[model samples]
Target: MVENKASAPGKGSLLQQTRLVCGLTLFTFVFFHFLNHALGNISLSAMNWGQDIRYVVSGKRLFPWIFYTAMILHSGLGLWKLAQRRTLKMPVWEATQIILALLIPYVLIKHIFVTRGAGELYGSNISYQHELTALWPNDALWQSALLIVVWSHGCIGLHYWLRIKRWYRRVQTPLLGVAITLPLLALTGWISAARRLELSGNQKLNVTAEQKSNLLEIVSQVQLGVYALIALVLLTLVTKYALGMFQQRISVTYLDQKTVKSVPGPTLLEISRMKGVPHMSICGGRARCSTCRTLILSGEASLSGPSKTEAQVLKRIGASANVRLACQIRPMTDIVVRPLMGHGKKMQAPGLSDRYRWGVEQPVVVMFIDLRGFTSLSEGKLPFDIVFILNRYVDGVVKTVNRNNGMVDKIMGDGVMALFAVESDMSSGARDALACIQAVSKELEKVNEDLAAHLAAPLRIAIGLHGGTAILGRIGLDGQSGVASGLTALGDVVNVASRLEGVAKEENVLAAVSMDLITAAGITPAQNLTERSVAIRGRSGPISVICLDETAIVLADFKPAS
Candidate 1:
């Protein structure tokens, strides 16, 4: 099939985008709701202003449907995701919030149904006063549950958004304190109003005919709304599943080693859409799911930091520095980032070995080994057979190196370089070198055993061990630095080890050694050898070289490499 080069907008990509947009809209509604509720304790007039604001909001014909649609999509997608997962292993508070969210439609159904439906039916608009009066004496347990869940969900989303910023950590405690305290204040006010009403005799008085009719009207409207949401929710469920099936996509980035892709004039959501990558913005691209997260490894200047929604979500997730929601960033220049977790192929976890595992300031031991006769062996075998043999040989060598606290660096045509103590706290380079040599010898025996049935002759490996001070930093081109730069050793020690490996191959010995500097630093070779003066390639005159005896294999014939 001819690949379609023209990148069209993907299926259900718009649904994901709509979900994000709606989620953001909902978050905005949440902010507005709380801000209005917060106004109540200050003054009744301030609370009345909330009615005016609601009037303006309701005046927009699109507002109600937009919000309702968002609620359905958000709830439906969340339900599907929850169902798909094997376990809901979230924190306790988070789990509670999820339960609360599940209960919200029921809790809220009464309010929306009664007020909006009654206003539409009886033509008697229910004002804030009418709504407030219902809860004046005290909120029901379910109402309180609604408030807690709604507020907690909003706060958790906000916290996750903020946690991505480096500065967010600094004020996280204070922010959390405020988030917790304000909700308590809202609940307290509701309880106080409820207590005062409970003490009053107004509710106990005989209800007028009009008031009784209004109450029935409100009750019936709520029932209607509940049925409506249930039907729409089911419709949404079927639609989401139907749409999701055709919405498969893959995301890609042209990020370099120290960068993430940045796009101009596009929200991260739009970019992902354009790039054909599958992402979740369950709250719409409103920074709620945080599934659209990316790490700005190198191009921070190119991208904007977290918006309010993103800021809040990051805090909840406790995301580290350098992380940001793609939806939040609008970079003018190119940036590179792996989507923290999403539908794109799991790109290899970058920088796990480079930046996080090893630092340059640490002391490390460097070892270089070249398998002698590897080139000649390759010449005699088929291309596939050569690869097979070389791979087995390299695998054995690398496993041994790793067992000794060394990371195998680049494996050349016939040689491999590795380092030890790069990640160690106590500088175990010398010990690591000793272990690597023994490992190589032991692994070689296994390789020989396996090769005995395949090849005409046994393969021999020559390893040169050296230890001392080195930068032990990642080294490569400007970009693509981490692919092979995990644990590099710089300084004279590395150079000497390479030279010594050459000497080992030339000397026809299983091992070759270095100068007194290495010996002084406590790097003992596997075998005893005579110190000989030899003219080195780069050095001035004859340099002292410790040569290990070729017969050292007899001493270590018992132990397996593993």
Candidate 2:
């Protein structure tokens, strides 16, 4: 028997929320630090002015506690997450983030101790002037490296956190520009300040040998502590794996009937990764995306219920009772499940709801447009010329479709697939499609006139329009924020439409529109066009269609159904 669980309303897991808040707080500090460094490009006084303002804000009694708390919590949580991973096999960006994060303490500890630690412990007044003098010519490389590593790690974290959001995609390009430019300016400013300090006599920080030695000792100890903590996490993971080897293993059966056995501790996603199975985890198993959700077919009693965070995500996506996040579920007994989303497939638009993004059967008008004789026309032309002509032709078709309220679903070489009424009723979509065909004819005329010198003859195209129920949904990379994915219609209707376009090409007519579309649009064929029952490839029965020649197409009339 399948156990059904109800979804609960919640925000997210407490650990994830805490990690995000702390990460944002630390990122704010790093952003300002880079800005302060950038001030050195103007002059040493400017850098000092900026640092003074920074100190005024961050040095407040309450602010330091917030800052230090955020720093500690953020770092600690990062380590905890790393320790939780069942497998280190991950994307390059994830690996890069981990490597850079580990390097941060080693590169930053001495700087932090010499500056903030020295100020607190030894009453040392360290200024940008002293810093520049000390860092130039010898320690500059490490300081620059520190700047890059810290900034990159912060940006990567922020990017992954925000990339799932729709609004973030709109501003990602500008944000990326800022991310790149700000660090470069800061590095330039640091070098500029250092060069200025070198021109003048190098000013050393006023510190006694004993104070310096004490700070160095503290830095060393802190570094050693970081190493120890990392080693402990690694050892714990190794120990856990060794013990798991002795534990009873459980079986997970996929939709393909392939079964894999693993220890009960790891999540289903981790098990897939461990066994070299392909699984989608767009948010890197952070419980941030619903792409990794699966439908449990059996042995539901073996799996625990969804956590609050998991339930929240499931509710947001409107998953059924048997659906569970693969990244969150750990099955203790043998179970059969199927991943809902395909691995490496793009998800629907970010703005769309799960029902629409994933899929829904709906009535839609599918149209296919293919250019005629374009391949032969391009046989002798230069590649550049061929591309130019194709672009102009495609531009005309796309514009006409959009003008008539149609969605250009896919553009293949010299062919185009469009859908109408995806958001409206079938009748309205059919009307729009009918109007689009006329508009496309007129637009192609204009395109031909414009490219008259480039073409041997006037450009021609064949169109097929069919309206019926098709599965409408978005497909593409999950969490791509709508950049690389789009809505599409799939079913027999689409296939029939494509085949009808071929019929038009074979018959040397302007279009072969299905009677289904004409009736849906409430239009009567004004011209006496021959009606034919053509058997579409891959379809069982013959479809009734009217082939419209160029003259008959220009004379076609449309009227709305009452």
Candidate 3:
């Protein structure tokens, strides 16, 4: 079975944690800076007032050191990550983020040197007015692009980091609105402030020729130093790549007997991408999503033990000891493996909304309906006739479920499984399930009449309904061109519901509705209905259910309790 792991708290690597903290610190700084710039929507003095508060908060003694440290660490870690990447091929968002990040230092170094460097070295009091005037009409476009690039890169980082969180998915839409609005407002405020300064005829900063020359010389040196640092990082990566060619190579044999040889350092995922092999990595091999999990068929001893993060993910998915995240393990020896989730087809697009994709636990109403004696009815029938009748029955059931705000999860031969309340509350879901059962009975009557000549006897269906918390998610591989095959619910609730259908069939009743579902739906059981506690298979205890032979009696008479 393919296992999709949910996010869980794990003992993360120190490097990962440190990078996260540093990135958050830098993002915080940028957030406040944007807010300060947004003050330009008011007056020039308002922007200055905001800047003064910023100075007290982040521009002061220790705060400045913290900010600078975070900036350096964040940049260094980013470069380190780039150098560590075994293959450059990645999702568009990941690639875009890296490219934007690379551009940041180049675009931002001059601005930083001109503002903070000037203030520290020459005691220059640079305000919004001074900066806006210096940048407007000439360098404004570059600065605007800089704002967008920095904000986009930061937002992308935050997205990947936080998208694993369940709550983050719920609020991402509004957060997206804010993400887009803030930078635009900052730019508008900046233009407004700049225009105000232009009108006032005060665009130049007071500075001596020597100070100007000295600042320019320092800025040029800093820019060249940044360029040199970037070139050095590239050289290091190229050197590593060149050296890897001469290193002892290890082979990975896939289940299809396709073998790929790679240097010992790169993870299985990196190897797959390098060799143009399709692999699933929904979280971009970050170990947050376990789609890239593989079962070690042999040579497990040659692979390293799972990292804390990998262990946490594997445990969450309830994977066996042999299962490991392909993105995390770098095998030192030849190994044969089978990817748990099928290759490229299973890889969900990164940053895809999790509303219906990711597994989430919620209260749901599950219903299972199976046609009684379907095998007996089809015994003497031709294949075409059997298919025609089955399709008619399934079509009717599907329509009935849809009309009652329920989703038909699956159909296996003559059985139909459906879920309710996936997009609604539990109460409504329970009501929908009950209503669906009632409608299905009537719909089945029409099917019986339509195929009476072909039927041995009028068709009869047994239905079971139960309500509980279950994991709801889209399962099964994608169809052609990445169309979802189906959404399904998993857990004890679904199992119980299926078992209850068997009870209904054995008791010869139209439906067996669990008391849990009845109570949740606020429906009062009818006096004539059969009430009993039946032990479900695979479960220890008996569950109370109300069985009804006639759908009209209870369905029409019962009213939902307020």
Give me the runs in candidate 2 sitting further than 4 Å from their true place: 1-11, 56-61, 343-397, 400-407, 410-473, 476-486, 489-562
What number of clashing residue pairs does each candidate have, in the order they appear? 36, 3, 0
lDDT of 3 by residue, 457-562 (tens): 9999999889987877777645446566578999999988998999989999989989889888777776666679989888999999888776453466566665
Work out the TM-score per prediction: 0.37, 0.66, 0.75
RMSD of 2: 11.4
Model 3 local distance difference test score: 0.81
**Model 2 over residues 473-499: C-alpha lDDT tens digits?**
777644555354677888888999999
Model 2 reaches what TM-score against the true structure?
A: 0.66
Stretch of 10 with least lDDT, candidate 1 = 1-10
Q: What is the C-alpha lDDT of each candidate?
A: 0.59, 0.81, 0.81
User: Between candidates 2 and 3, which one is better according to TM-score?
Assistant: 3
The alpha-carbon deviation from the true structure for residue 387 of candidate 1, after best TM-score superposition, in angstroms, is 53
